[model samples]
Target: MNKEARLSRLTRMALGRESSDYLSRDVDELTMVEELKNKYGLENVYRFDVGKNIDGFSPLIQDVLETPELLGLITGSLTEYPENSYQRLRRQLSLHHDIPPEWFVFGAGLESVIDHIARAVLDPGDHVLIPVPNFDVFQSVSFRMGASLTFMEMPGLCWDGNILESLCRKMKEKTYRLVWLSNPVNPTGQFIPQDDIHRLLSHASETRTLVVVDEAYGEYTDRPHAVRSASSLLKSYPNLMVLRTFSKVHCLPSARVGYMAASSERLRQATNTYRPMFPFSWFSLYMAQLAVLDGDYVNEIRRRNQERKKCFFNRIRQQDSGLETFMFLESDTNTLMFRHRDLGADALHGLLAERGFLTANLNRLTGIQNQGFLRMTLHGDAVNEKFLDACRWCGRHLFR
Candidate 1:
């Protein structure tokens, strides 16, 4: 058969989605980080575009790097590695969350775990409801499974206030295969209030819809008065699945370690069947185990982030009084989503880069209509000053 005739119907269907230049463009933006150095001098640009890069190399990473004989440890880990390292990690998490070890499934990242769940639960043309603007992964996985998608649109800066009620009503009327949501939501940095989350979960439970919650930003929101993560409710809502990562909270994105928490009878069992015999690299697994053991480092980062969060916002507001800047204080995470009327998100992104500051351009991520909202990460003092100075520079020079 000719090459064209050799492909399955599924392949042809997927290819049709991929064949769009717009789809390819979105894929390119998601995967690649464009270098934005000096237009002429080619100087380094401080990236603020990624709202989630670690403020600094984590102490756990530092320990691995600083150890002169770390190679000896890495090479010899297999010799004395625990026979049940995953079980041990699960035990640690189980103790932390008061959950059974069997309820959790580990993966390379929350994203990979999400894919596994989609594979296990979805059938062709199943309905998937994702609240926008949200992490693109949910949309991608839904489409990959030949599931239909209906987005409940929210402004890029924050969630629509009626989302919970609207979602519950929708769930009652339709049998959705899955629902995806993020805490301290991506790009926007808005978090759903805890009470609303409970109501939504109750509705999903009654309807038997699979609800996946990405809590990658859980660590940052682990503040004294912040909204708590949905993990605490896992025991009550078997229908709920929480996706968390060391990537965002523990600052171990490169290690790509993440896990899923679900009830023993549902996602936990199905996802286990989908789990590979060899899920990820041994080195990553080793590092993840160590990260869990080092709770001190995670705590310190969170504490410092809280203090830095205030200073970062204050610095931005103190800039030129002439330019009106709107700051969204609704987020309880490390990222701050904001915008200025003088520059739309895309144009502002380029201008900030010109001054050696990188910011997450929300126009593309949040949908074309919300071209004004942009998000920035809270970083260490040095990086914060660079970003703050860039903002000051923009107010003085880039005003429309």
Candidate 2:
């Protein structure tokens, strides 16, 4: 086949493929809830199924509803209040992270931002490096843009500096345009050190490649400074783009608010080329603004989350002798990744779902081979206890 024909075939394959249904659950909604109620008890049944912070609920909703000034700022028209509000937000975020306001582009969400970045920077067949066991959104967007994804398997339970050097070598081998990674990576919850991040960026800069860092869970980390904030890195590396979201940290996933910090030139190019779709709803923008400004609520959620994660770690250590357990990669995040040799995670996940517990199936996540590892999001004391009991029960019944 000719080159054009091969390109056409690849595009067809991409466009024809369905969006991933990993988020889909087939259990009866009512039955699932009832089972949750039964296992964890009606009052204590906590859903750690997603990355949302339960503590941010009341303050987030309350702030959005009570503040009308926050509601009126839509994309098209900018009155003084709305303009000032946006400027204020930009100023605060820029000051907090020590980046220029011009370096950031506010978008509908991180997924939208990724799509925009892909559109701006990638051509068909261009190579994009990504660590495996990632959020599917990265691969999905890259494929849609006709970019070839090069997978770099993360060193299990730790960040290996060698991986970054190897990735640099891979970049040198091709006209690879981008490197995408998640700090405190999803599923594994491993934190990449600042030095390693610097080496990656240095390599990318030398090769004229853009490094896209997704700090979606940076706020949850105990040592936030160890991982270079994308905003801060932008000053030195113009080729670096930092992606952040209100979804995980602020519990505003429904609000669909996210932003990218990069060099001013790159930010302008992305905004111009992609033309971000505006105003998911006046309500979404309002909620996002409220969430960002509500420092007390953010602090409270962080505090409770830290406490919950500590409690979970303690419980897991105590129970790990009999059951398979995954530990956080020496980071201050609430997610844990572990492997079980005897019971395949798919079978175990199914069994847990039947018993009213839901967790991320690690095997299906990255399509990487694993011995039944699963990722669990820690919610709070009650939820942590339930997960512990569920795992203990599963270990005894399923593994035995």
Candidate 3:
């Protein structure tokens, strides 16, 4: 096929995959919607999207909305809307990172920011380096921008020095424009060490390539502020940008607020070229400000996430030896990636979904040929127990 024809085909596949919400099966679990309607004689099923609340936002959100001052700030800010609230949010985020306010652009979300970055920086046929087993949005962005994505596997189990050497080698062969990576990787939940991050930044500077570090899950880590220190690397390495969001940690996925930090000049160019509007609602901004500023809420969520992770992993280890379970490289985060001996991930996922449990099928995520590997997110004691019970049931019935 001609290059154009091939590109068109790839775009079609990417668009189809991106258009569908991958976690719909999980939504089917909220039996209370219809059950409550039938029991209470309500007119319609008042469905609560349970899957959306990975980070519980009940009493805290309610309290934030009740504050008149907070609401006033949101309304006042909206009156003379700055070029973009995204930019203002980016400035607030940079303050946390100790990065200058001028060093970033605000986008509706990390996905949009990445898409804009790809379009702004890469020409058709340009090569972009990315680590595999990443969020699927990276593939969509790369394909949409007409850039050829070059995949590099992360060092297994941990960050390896050789990965940097390999990246340096690739840089020498071609003048690649961008290198995109997640700090604490999605699905795997592994955090690359500070040394490795520095090495990657150095390599990027040497190659004159931009290194985009996606730190979406940074706040969920034990060191909720480690990513703040990461911004310091940009001082010496102009070719570095850090991406952060309120989605994962703040549990504000519906807010759609994410931003990037780079040199002030880069930020200016990005804002001028692709100015992101207030895609997020006023209520979202109010809630996000409340969430971010409340240190207690952030720390409590992190602590709970850590506790849940430990409980889940401990239970997994105690499972019968007949089930082949492989733990993720990084165990600190709330997500666990594992592989079993017999059951295929798809079948296992379906079985779990039927029982009101939802997990990420790694087989589909990494495109790795693993029959039994799946990723589960840890919520709390009650939720963790429910998940473990589901797994145990699956082990006895499916594996047997």
Candidate 4:
């Protein structure tokens, strides 16, 4: 048998579809930082690319690392399995959301959850509807599952309510097995209003399509008294499933803990069947359980995230006339995507790299036109100020 012939058709197809431009490959954010540090020296390089670089783990979470019990788990758990299958974490999350614990399906991360969703819902030649300028994972996972894709493009990275309404109306006309959505969308951080999502959900329900809303950044958008997560609509829309991760606002990307909630028992059973066994480490599960319990800390992260973003945006708008080359796109979350009016995203990315700053190059990450946009996750005050200075220096040179 020939070497290429031995590979599955789906594997070959997925390989052909992989983009070298995407940063989520083997060269991840930290690896990029380390490589840059090697080239530019340690003290000079700044990481503006990854959202996981946000403020420290909550003090409540920090306290757990100091515990003797958690340390003992490191050496003790080689043979023993997790006894409760993460029931404690699920219970905490259920109580937090006022949902049934059994509705939750745990995965190693949102990436894993997404893969499970594709496995559970997609079949060969099945149709999947995705709104582009969103996470690439949805497209990759679905395609790998032998699903054909239809994309609704949001050119400005923010969905116009009217346009989304139109799409919702047309969605019922098509037979899609899966509908992928990202609330507080990745790269751009723009959110679809609940009403718009509800409309989509209604249409999807009629079509019997499984609508998966990825709420990885839901913490940044959900308020104290108000609800923003589509998880809130699970009861109202049985066709809906909401994906959440500990990676974003909880600052637990290292934990590899993510889960999805669906009110439909059938969907829940399918997802649960597809989920990876022992998806979380003992420590990771404990950390997530603690993180969920500390609601006040999560609230603080949300508030401070907004404050930092607002300050950064204000500074950009108020920059001197000569330094007006860059434009900040409005975003609803801590991660923001912006662009240079004069320079292309690749050019700006190279320029920033030369200046010892790393940012996400958002050139071909979308379907309805690439805007030469670059994205950055908001950092602390000192780091943001330094990044602003780098921008000012670049702006002055361009505008002068």
**Model 4 lDDT, residue 275, Cα:** 70
The order of the candidates by lDDT, greatest first, is 4, 1, 2, 3
TM-score of every model versus the real structure: 0.86, 0.82, 0.81, 0.93
Q: What tens-digit string does per-residue lDDT give for candidate 4 at 1-400?
A: 7898989999999888856244655656666667777876657777677777378677898887888886677778766775446778778888778788888888889999899888888888998888877788888888899998888877555688766765676576778898888888886788788888888888787888888899998888888754478888988988999999989888899889999999999887888887757777787887888888787887888888888988887777774633476778888888777788888887788878867888888787856246778888888877888888877776665656
Which numbered prediction scores highest in lDDT against the true structure?
4
Off by over 4 Å in 3: 1-55, 58-61, 67-91, 155-157, 222-229, 319-329, 367-371
**What is candidate 1's lDDT per residue for 1-400, written digit by digit as tens?**
6897888765667767632111244445422334444352435566555546465546776787678788886777766533334877788778766778888888777778888988889899899988887877787777878899888876544565577778888999999989999886765666677677788899998998988888788776665433367888888998889888878766667777789988847667788677775666667766777777766666777788778877766665665533355444546778777687676777777778777666766665534345577777777877777776666667666635
Q: Per model, how many backbone clashes are there?
A: 3, 1, 0, 0
Q: What shift in Å separates residue 282 of candidate 4 from its native position after superposition?
A: 0.8
Q: Which candidate is the best by TM-score?
A: 4
Model 1 misplacement above 4 A: 1-5, 18-35, 57-61, 77-85, 155-157, 223-227, 319-330, 366-370, 395-400
Q: Which stretches of candidate 4 lie over 4 Å from their true place?
A: 28-32, 225-227, 319-322, 396-400
Poorest stretch of ten by lDDT in candidate 3: 44-53
RMSD in angstroms, all models?
A: 3.8, 4.9, 5.3, 2.1
TM accuracy, model 2: 0.82
TM-score of 4: 0.93
CA error at residue 106 for candidate 2, angstroms: 1.6
Write model 2 residue lDDT over 1-400, tens digit each, in one string: 6665656655777768655424654557567677677765544434556666666554656754666664454434353233212565577677667777767687777888888888788878898988776777888778888888888776654458777777888988987888888887765677777778888888888899888888888777523333246566677998888888888868778877788887858455665467434535555655665666656665666677777777666766674444454333334566676555567878777656655667766666664555576666776687667676766677677535
**Which one wins by lDDT: 2 or 4?**
4
